[model samples]
Target: MSRAQNETYLLPFDNRIEINPALAGLNKNSSYQTGNQYHFVNSEQTYNLFYASWDSYSNKLKGGVALNFSQGMLSGQNISTSAIGFYYSGFPIKINNSRILLSAGTEVLAATKHWAVAFLNNVIPHDNDAPIEQGESFFRYYIFKPKFGFLWTNNSLQIGITSTVLHTRDVAFSLIEPTTTLGYTLYVSKKVDKRVRDLYSRPFEMSPELVVFYREEATIARLRLLAEYTDKTWGAFVQNDFTNHISTLGGTIGYRHNFMRFNLNAGMGIPGISDYNSFMCELSLNIIVPPFSHSKYNPWAPAKN
Candidate 1:
């Protein structure tokens, strides 16, 4: 419905889409990183509730919800600023596979409001809103992470290396800059009993990873091919979206069964389909479950020096 309503008022969370990975892998990898035999669950499992959203149609209220600091207003609109991200990565070594993780988050909003409040988790319209003057997460950019990966599963194949900082400042409304991102994953599990179910459920996996994205001047890359099914409750993945080669082709759909994990990531741009054809949707939630490596032991087990 936006024909041209440029009121110089852009703080509705800048409308969100794809969201760069929306905190990546749920805590650090999306639904696709169930690699290294599904280890690395450093704990920090929130989502009793977290909020964000924005859809469009500005004079006020189009898909409402948005929140960063929240001043008030949802449908009538008026909370002009937002940003809240708190991620946790655990597994300092309770035993099992050697793993370490530290995920961080922080945000500020304006130009309308950022992430549009992350889509109704804040409760409102439904589909992005929030921005006041965002130049891409203005003033306060956050993401300080530390990760170490290891897996040597009797030679079937499993490799790991991770580092993420995407962008950060010392704190509050901070936008220090330079940005950095590099991630990795590899998987192998082929039990495949194929009778009905339950022999470890039905295993067959092949995951390849090389995701490096850095932004200051520039750098972006991706190479992810995954297929998985790991369970405690549920974890699933199906991916085939090469970053470039004309954006190649894209596909991703995830469901983390039960406690609540859902990702409907999208990307289908073969030159914007005639003029503008886009696909990017993310509705993430992990409100609070912070403490990891499977809480006590067997985080997947791969650290025995």
Candidate 2:
């Protein structure tokens, strides 16, 4: 069965803004809600995102690292937590005309016993590899989630594909290898080069998108749709827990200017088919350098100084 990265702490980061299409619209602010999977990572648009990765997010950086932070569907079950780990790229990278993305991640979940003993015999059960502190939950989970991506960027439109494992570390545990999530994630969205902005003004461009991901083995895995609409202000339209937890609607507001990306996401839990949930605002800034966009205005243009 597909497993989820119990790092519920990063739920907050999921509400933040992003450039990777796979993660862009699925947040708390938006009407889209997802299983307890970790969908957040460091700013990919930046030139130096290497520091905010798994082992590094907690070990090398030394600074605090967060993964997710969101309130669950149950009343009185408010959730706010973060972890030191890393996920994979939810987007594709283009080179000359080719695209490449490494779909993988590794981490040890600090889960309690209830979720641990269920599949205890199979996994290594700690003690080696990395030295974790004592008293810490042995629910340390690892994942080798693989992903597939497609990218096509010309002068008119930008589109792509991204998939994340529902849970890599699942089923039978191994004596040697680490574990990860099981299910898989797929993202199909398009960004058309609309009317020229006052220089890429938020009001001038339009990027509409759709999102869906699921896994049957993983009871928590479900399919959902998300669309990013922008005319003046960007709005992320979403549907959560469509597998069985229906009625949970979500949405987010976004705005972008040149090199800066901003976002605000809100999520609510559904009763009956869902759980009692409310809203939590999320904020984030992403710095991205277009792989093909030039910076000197015109590489061949003469200077006016």
TM-scores for all candidates: the values are: 0.20, 0.46
| The best candidate in terms of lDDT | 2
lDDT of 1 by residue, 4-84 (tens): 111111111111211221222222222221100010111321001123432111123211121122221222222222334
Query: Model 2, range 79-167, lDDT digits (tens) per residue?
Result: 12222333333344557854443323333322233333324433656664332222234333433333333345434344444444434
Stretches of candidate 2 off by over 4 Å are 1-140, 144-181, 192-202, 216-232, 255-258, 269-281, 291-305
CA lDDT, every model vs. true structure: 0.30, 0.35
Return the TM-score for candidate 2, rounded to 2 decimals: 0.46
Which portions of model 1 miss their true places by more than 4 Å?
1-73, 80-91, 97-100, 111-198, 203-305
- In TM-score terms, candidate 1 sits at 0.20
Minimum summed lDDT over a 10-residue window in model 1 is located at: 33-42
